[model samples]
Target: MNTNDLKIFEAVVESGSFTKAADIMFTVQSNVTARIKSLEEEFNAKLFSRTSRKVELTEEGKILMNYAKQIQHLVEEAKNEIISNETVNGHLTIGCMETTMTLKAPEILLAFGEKYPAVELEFKSDNRDSLISAVLNYKLDAAFVSGPLNISGLEKIKIKEEQLVILASSKEAGLNKLLAKEPMKSIVFDNGCIFRERLESWFSHKGIHNYKSIELNSIEGIINFVDAGLGISLLPEEVVSRYYQGRNICTYSLNKQLGTMTTLLVYRKGKAPSTALQSFIDMHIEDIA
Candidate 1:
């Protein structure tokens, strides 16, 4: 029931190792282990399945991690609000994809900061899957991501639409024809990316199987490899425009028949949004409308 114990548990989960968490907190590894043990004893539930190499969260541990994050977020928000006047100040954590960070967020972030200078913006950028998990875990106040996000216990609003495109080195001609004929070499984000999922589904439906795929973690890395003629990739049109415009890349629409994917603004349901969070969402609603 002690908040400090929850924090210690959270640190262990986030750091993925007691030794690493101890190092982060400038404490001894044994101390961190003792805190986790105390918490497990209090809850009468195991938190982690520990091995020599790695620590994996049990189902109970995963549930506790989610609640711990919520408690941490609430504590931070309370302090920030109490310290502020009639202004939006304090930390505002947001999660976003690298592609969305490049294409969609800069102008919005700039405008929001200008209007609410007291607010401290904290950003976490990664693939879409991690972004969703962060928001769900209360590590983020909100996130801008591509959707039909169907996660339980979350609220979402469709903010915009973006097209997914297949790109190759512009010098490498006839990519569109090649895709129709065979699956060309592809560079993609890991399997969790929506574009990657959609692309895979599209190929499967087309009965195309003549492709090799490489998984890259970053959008920039994927584009770099594609531009070097290492492979082709499917990316959001806006991301392609921002990163690969005027580069040796050509884009083909991934079948307008598939329709436009929605970009969503998401937050945890039932949790009241802070003034700053509401303000940010309102601005997007106005802009998108």
Candidate 2:
């Protein structure tokens, strides 16, 4: 019905829950529901299929999402062009892998905020695939993802490379005991994580299949699980050093190709960069190298 309605609709579909949409949009859940209802009434069509646990867009909603995104983009571009941002003033949503958030991102995040205090920066912590998907959907201005990323529809600038390391508990038995342990559990992030893929490949290449995986949603939990002798995990050496320095952990180096991975700052290739995003990339992308 209106721009605000479209914005709310887009947020709901993207967030997939009224509660999350309300938080992202900075409003109440009832208000989000009301606005969406108003939109559906105005358009005389149901936009979302709502259930107890999930909110998904109906077919009509999908078509409207494309238009809503375009409208939002144009509105954002217009605002950026019309405003004089001699000191950049806009919102930038950046998605990142949780691992990068813990180790590599703090200094850059702090510096960026201090330098451009007026720009509103929101950071989302997610796994690699979700981060890339968010960027493609225009939910984020950019994302920090680990690579040898060869994904289409993205432009990636390598910022840093770190060696992936195998971690085991210092007090726990080494390989022999590890291999013989009843359920050789792998501590890992949820399925879409690249590091998990690497760990799986490493096991298969070594003819060690049938290992059970303990899927965790956060890096700290995974590290703690591994450190407590529950299972082993794969993580970047930089991350392990930064967080577990001087802790009771043993690190094993991997083969070159399997060990090294690049951290890339990526954005949608054909999408026009807004002033906020462009300034961000120019400041960090070039500054890093």
Candidate 3:
């Protein structure tokens, strides 16, 4: 019914709980529930299917969510435009893959921090699919993701290309020797990771369909596991070189077909980026170019 009501709705949709949305909105659960109920009544539809554990958006809720995001975006754009002549101070939430967080984010963070100290910067490390979803939902101002992207409603800029490699313990001399280990394990990120998907494809290409997967969430954890000979992993060469340079690890290049992936900086296509976000994008472009 109003922007405040829509804000509560978005929060509930994102957090998937009226209680959690209350926590985010700095209100109580009853208020969140009342606002959602009011919105549903106004629209003459049930917006969410509630359960004891969580809430799931209904079909009508999905439609409203799309328009709610647009409204929120427009509201922010208006605020940004009104303050265009003022100091460059705003919040930016950026998302990226864990590998990029390790290899690329530090320099960008350092430079951006020094230049725009007034802006608040928050970074989230997630897999490609999660990052894409966050960007699409207005949760992230921008994201750095692995690409050859073709998603609608998003704009992308190729920032860098990383060569993918098979990382193994230094005890293994080569890829074949590493593959010979019985019950070969793969140390990888959780599902929805682009690198993990590529690793699976590589295994399938080699007629390997039954290897065990050791899912770890952090880049350091994956590298440490690989170094300990617990398993092998597919990761960026730059990431391995940077984090495990002198450790007991070796990397073998993948064939060209599966070897390279581009890192793209992506944002919503039609939305005008906030001052802080636009400044960060400019700095990223200059840094990478």
Candidate 4:
């Protein structure tokens, strides 16, 4: 119906609870319920199937959600386009892989902040897959992820190439000795991580399929586990060198095929970037190129 109705609907869908949506909208539960009821009545369709715990979107609601998101994005884009260049102030949410956040984000973000102090920036760290999903869903304006992306509705700019390396404890003399270790445990981020996928591929290439993995969410945790001789891991060389750099850790380079990965700044295709996002892209493109 109205933009306010769509906003409330989006909030309820995102939070999955009427009370939670009300809290997000800074309104009461009754107001949220009334808005949803009005929308359902107006459309003559059941929007959400409700349970005591939460609500699930119905078929009609799913279709409406797609349109609602596009409308919201277009509204925001129009506002950004009409605003004067001298006042480029808005929220910019970016998603990033953990390793990229560690090695590349700080300096760039610092400089961007200095230049555009009024623009709010929020950086969320996650695995490549999750970050991509967030960007597709319009939860992130853009993301820093590994390159060679072939997904539809996404555009990417190459930021830099990073050499991937195998990390082990110093107690291991060489790659051969490390591979010969019993159980062949690996320290890695969870399933959706690009590095973890590469680690698995490397193991498969070497005809080793029985290795065990210790999944962690933190880059520091994986590095510490590798340093403790608990397991080996595959990560960008810069990440290991910059973050750990401990005497207990040893780095082994992958063969050229597995060694190289490009970090890319990815955003939705066909959408004009917000002024703040455009500024970030312009600032980095030359430096990275």
The top-ranked prediction according to TM-score is 4
Candidate 2: pairs in clash = none
Give lDDT tens digits, candidate 3, residues 179-264: 77667789999999988899999999988877999999898899889988899999989886766789899888899889999889
What is the C-alpha lDDT profile of model 1 across 46-104, one tens digit per residue? Answer: 99999998798999998888778888778877887788868778878888877777776
Q: Which stretches of candidate 1 lie over 4 Å from their true place?
A: 13-22, 27-64, 180-183, 257-259
Instruction: Flag clash pairs in model 3.
Output: none
TM-score of each: 0.83, 0.81, 0.88, 0.92
- Which tens-of-lDDT digit does each residue in 1-289 have in candidate 4? 7899999999999999999999999999999999999999999999999998899999999998988888898787677667745777777899999887787678867988898887878899998889998898888999999888988889889888889999989876877977887778999988889999999999999888889999998888987888788999998988867767755898888898889998899988986787878988888897866
Which tens-of-lDDT digit does each residue in 9-70 have in candidate 2?
Answer: 87898789999989989999999999999988887889999899998889998888977886
What TM-score quantifies how close candidate 4 is to the native fold?
A: 0.92
lDDT of 3: 0.87
TM-score order of candidates, top first: 4, 3, 1, 2
Per-residue lDDT, model 1, residue 201, is 72
What RMSD does each model have against the real structure? 3.2, 4.1, 2.6, 1.9
Candidates 2 and 3 compared by TM-score, better number: 3
TM-score of candidate 3 versus the correct structure, residues matched by position: 0.88
